[model samples]
Target: MITNFLLDHSALVPVAILLVALVCAVLGLLFADRRRILWALAGVSSLPVFALTLVPTVHTIDEILCTVQFSVPTLGAVELLANVALFLPPVCFAALASRRPVTMLAAGSVLSAVIETLQALVPAIGRACDTNDWLMNTIGAVLGALIAAGTAWLVDRRAQSGSSTGAISS
Candidate 1:
């Protein structure tokens, strides 16, 4: 079943993933600040988003149409999970890379919607636009934003505690 997925999908997926990794490594070297590095990573992470969704794949339908189906639980667990995982890392890096998690979340949500719209409007992409995919992606983005916020809070709490002890010692 897993191998069947590759038959219809673009063969360049593995190559794209590797290329994204290389780009991230290159960007990491160029950025000095931690937040800047994270932002670069976030941008690099979005490569897969386009590679996966926009790449032309083998299609059975001869006619191209733009249609959106509402979120339906018809997809298999694996496909659903994959959709969610797709957006998670990018948004996580984006939120962590910036002072504004909400802005990142909004951007992520809009990105998801735009991707879906592209799939619908562009027939050459050989991908169907589905609301379920957008919904799952948004959920993943939300989770990523929450994780970033939580991580920042924890780090701040630790730093504040350490500073308090240092101040007392002084």
Candidate 2:
């Protein structure tokens, strides 16, 4: 299955993700508006997230097992902020790039859930699943969506009022 392949070839997964992102960017570059480049970046901006969570960095485990019971998030400020930061870029970019920011929010939330679930279900990966991480990630996604929505509203208002960016006669 695809999951087995990704787990076995951890190193190649990043390469493949980057390659896809590159392809998306190139296609976006050819678009008339070229806003799709934001979409491409938004999706792949999770490189840090994938690198930190998916890659097995933890060492010397007491038992080679996965934690099924999801516990409360007890990580300190730094770790908590890092988790939130990880999802912010991708979701923000996705929102700015698309008219439907909700899709980006949903994608970010689902992405976090899937990552946490994988960590809990797979013991060999050496990652711990926590509800806290998911919560923070979802928060970041929501913030991104909200920011984009506010920006869109401002743009619409400006257009309706026939206001320009302080332009002068040519």
Candidate 3:
């Protein structure tokens, strides 16, 4: 039934839900006067995805640690890319919501560090805490924050230009 489907696509389920939630949150932010709530939702939405990323598929820790290990070359590159994607959206949302790039960057760093530490300490989670993963996640968050800042700047510039042009015409 539904359980069979979820079992088959466990990795995809949370990511899909997160993507859907992100779209809804963005749409809500567009119409809502109180954007902070939507921003908070955006921030909180990462939790389930994070948990899914750490979830142990097996009762044994061996597979978990091995799967999360840091490697170089083709597989490593792919894993690093996945980590970047995982952290990017949450950081972008945080930066956009708070309008503070530095804060978002710091928050993203701390969050990644904490997740890694927890994974290393918690045997039940059965996930490896690789420094490489932490580094990649932080990089992604910083990039997201930078992108958000740039977008805000562009928007403000456009708004200013529009106002000035209207004033000149008037």
lDDT scores for all predictions?
0.68, 0.65, 0.65
Give the poorly placed runs of model 2, Cα more than 4 Å off: 1-33, 58-76, 161-170
Between the candidate structures 1 and 3, which one is better when assessed by TM-score?
1
Per-residue lDDT over 76-138 for candidate 2, one digit per residue giving the tens place of the 0 to 100 score? 344554566567667766776785679989989999999988777766677778777888788
Q: How many backbone clashes does candidate 1 have?
A: 0
Q: Model 1, range 45-100, lDDT digits (tens) per residue?
A: 78988888888888733445555555543334445555665776687677777856
Q: Candidate 2: lDDT of 132?
A: 79
Candidate 2's TM-score: 0.64
Query: Candidate 3: where are CA atoms >4 Å away?
Result: 1-34, 37-41, 62-76
Q: Which residue pairs collide in model 3, if any?
A: none
> How do the residues 82-155 of candidate 3 rate in per-residue lDDT, one tens digit apiece?
66656766776677677787898899889888888777777687677788888778876876677667656665
Please list the Cα RMSD from the true structure of every candidate, rounded to 1 decimal place. Answer: 6.9, 10.1, 5.9
**TM-score of every prediction relative to native:** 0.74, 0.64, 0.68
Candidate with top TM-score is: 1
Model with the higher TM-score, candidate 2 or 3:
3
Deviation in Å, model 3, residue 134 alpha carbon? 0.2
Provide the lDDT at 141 for model 3: 81
Q: Let me know the TM-score candidate 3 reaches against the reference structure.
A: 0.68
